[model samples]
Target: MRLSHLADYAVVLMTAAARYPAGARLSATELAADTGVPLPTTQKLMGQLAGCGLLTSARGAAGGFALALPAADISLADIVEAVEGPIALTLCSDSNNHECILDAHCRVKPHMGVVGNAVRGALGAVSLTELAR
Candidate 1:
């Protein structure tokens, strides 16, 4: 399945952050300019990433954002999850979500976890460092 635009933008924004020297603080405006993502989108993403503990933020005249973890320690899955919530390929894959009408007789429901895990695993194997490079 294709990633949503927000998830894709999170990856782009994160890779741009990963390109900076470790612990170097950066502003969303700078990231927007660097990655060509719109400023408001970048700000929203920065807030989301920070709220999820993927990025750290500080406020003040010198306020900005920095990676909470090293690039190698952060996976693509983490970035995607920070913006997309969870990596479920189908509604059936999420144990807590029962909104799918097909849940009643779906034969493929049980195997959805395996599929979701495989997708998450593939994404987890790719780190921010690799993406930035």
Candidate 2:
């Protein structure tokens, strides 16, 4: 499945953050310029990332955003889930998703967890350190 533009933007923003020295704080405007993502989008994404615990935020003259964990500890899946929620390829596979009309008889739903787990596992293998390189 294709990533939404927002998810892709989050990846770009995160990769940019990963390039900085550990615990380095960066402003959204700077990252917006660095990654060519718009200021509004960058600001929005920065807040979302911080809210989801991927990034930490502080206020004051020297305050900005910093990665909550080191590059090696943060995975692509974490970044993706921060902005896009879980990585369920099919609606039937999501634990919170119960609106599917086919849930009652769909035989494929049970097996979808394996597929989703595999996809998530693949993403989890790619770290921000690797992506930043």
Please give each candidate's TM-score. Answer: 0.95, 0.95
Clashes (backbone N, CA, C under 3 Å), per candidate, total 0, 0
Model 2, span 6-71: residue lDDT tens: 999999999999999999999998999999999999999999999999999999999999999999
Give stretches of model 2 more than 4 Å off.
none
Question: In candidate 2, which residue pairs clash?
Answer: none
**Best TM-score goes to which candidate?**
2
Clashes of 1: 0
Q: Candidate 1: which stretches are off by over 4 Å?
A: 97-101
Q: TM-score of the candidate numbered 2?
A: 0.95
| lDDT agreement with native, every candidate | 0.94, 0.95
Query: 31-127, model 1: which lDDT tens digit per residue?
Result: 9999999999999999999999999999988889999999999999999999888999876688686687787888999998999999999999999
User: Best lDDT goes to which candidate?
Assistant: 2
Worst window of 10 by summed lDDT in candidate 1: 91-100
Against the true structure, candidate 1 reaches a TM-score of 0.95
